[model samples]
Target: MSKKQEQVLCIDRKTLPASWVTQRTVLSMDFPTFAATCTKAKCSFVRRGIAEEDRQKKQIIPYILLQTADGGMTAAYNRQGNEKRLHDLWSIGIGGHINPEDSAIGTDSFESILKKGMQRELDEELARRVAGDPIEFIGIISEDITPVGSVHMGAVFLIRTQDPEGYLPGDELRSFTWHATQKLSQLNLELWSELSLELINSLNPTL
Candidate 1:
């Protein structure tokens, strides 16, 4: 059988410019409106390999940060078998690229497409672990200094779970564990996760 073509969303950074994106790494509260405005400009889907070559294109990354009922957060270590760039880095959020398949669900609204894509990713990555929990839009993330960061921007979500203890490490992760937000300093966090922790603390001072 032929290899399945992987398609992902791509938008020219120039065509859909966001001043905040290039200026900083994370924009916790102001990101949603900015991201929505950019997505409405010019966004399309192309093969993942092709998209990777286009530095001018910004690929969307929907990240879900799991907030456990016990007031701790869960993180996963990317296994070597995962994408080389992400291997060994600890990720506090779970997410992936927004693909062409996501837009096919219902393209009438851009927000709908994004939400569907995130839900699809959640189902594929976390399975029934977060089945009925409410997910909320938290913010956006960007890191233009790195090669991968140059072509991607993150849309983050926050979801509270009653039993995050049931979530197991599988797929691209070597292991998954829950930790107090205060203990993040002792862990090796991915760049995005580090920014996420900052945002979480800013919003929830008690954490």
Candidate 2:
């Protein structure tokens, strides 16, 4: 199928209360309830093209942040990436639209299916064999001010890589650059990355 024709998942805006996705990048305490909303999301099926254009719907995406055991991250410049809005920008996360085929693992739960899709994205986007288990769900991100962010809600996840040198970029990403907190602000970050930087900076030894 074509990229635009791909069937993806989304939640109804009316069903997803405005309060659920705030200016805040992270969701805690009510995270379980927030995630449960995705599992209970109605009208989950929609074409990528239509979904991208529909602000009334929030495309549920798993934005996986690849980190080393020591908290270093694998980031890349995205000049040849799929999303044009993020062209020539830097990103710390690797993820894509969740499709119906994600359920091939025979899982009924949305979170399980979401994880499967996330792994598929990693396998497709990166050259190395990153560990699939023990991934952490950090938080959700939304940038209502931007057109691209207004339509989708990112379910942020963190997966660890053994070594930064072990991971390689796919077609969209040129090379994987290892970065620590001190070096992040030097690059032009995409919307999610900008938010991710803030989230990471705000952390104090947790998440």
Candidate 3:
């Protein structure tokens, strides 16, 4: 199959049956805990460190969430052996570990970190489908904190492009779609840190 076609057929690893899509009991958590667990595991690319400015220790991961003009968002879903999972089950933002090169040279500013994270994720996921340069940054939506037990802070960013119609999901993402901002409430998203949701919601009113 062509690269474009392959991406279109991609299904998130955690595909759930249609019956569970609107199931109230199943939709209790909005933000998936898998990422947080991955962060805590400290495996491979993931790492724990302290901020250079204030020396505040934090678990940092390079993450990106796509924000369209209509306030729609995109996320990757992790399929844990469920065939009936809905499209939303595999929905998660793009992101990974921030490598040494990402912070190399003079690119240590928050903006720099954001730019590097977004670029790396897009390149890795859409490399087969997109031929041009990387996607541009719209703005920083908010910085989120994980729950008390977790030692990580989530940085939510708002990003977009003139043409968002052609995103090809690689192994990391099963599929991609534009989810309405208002619908975010339907998902059972638990912020890792305190007030993370409030911060993100405040920054993006539609969320």
Residue by residue across 97-197, what tens digits does model 2's lDDT show?
Answer: 98988987554577667778888898898777545445777777776778888888887777666666667777766656777756777888788877765
| lDDT, ranked from best to worst | 2, 1, 3
Worst lDDT run of 10 residues, candidate 1, spans 74-83
Error of 1 at 134 (Å): 1.0
Q: What is the C-alpha RMSD of each candidate to the true structure, in Å?
A: 2.7, 2.7, 13.7
2 against 3, candidate with superior TM-score? 2
Error of 3 at 28 (Å): 26
Model 3: residues with Cα > 4 Å off, grouped in runs: 1-56, 72-76, 79-91, 104-114, 128-149, 188-200, 204-207
lDDT of each: 0.72, 0.73, 0.39
Residue 37 alpha-carbon offset, candidate 2, angstroms: 2.5
- TM-score order of candidates, best first? 2, 1, 3
What candidate 1 gets wrong by more than 4 Å, as runs, is 1-5, 30-35, 79-81
Residues 78-190, candidate 3: write the lDDT tens digits: 43322232223443445544554565674365445445755776678654433342443221211222222132233444355445565566665554555555565565543
- What is the alpha-carbon lDDT for the whole of candidate 2? 0.73
TM-score of 2: 0.86
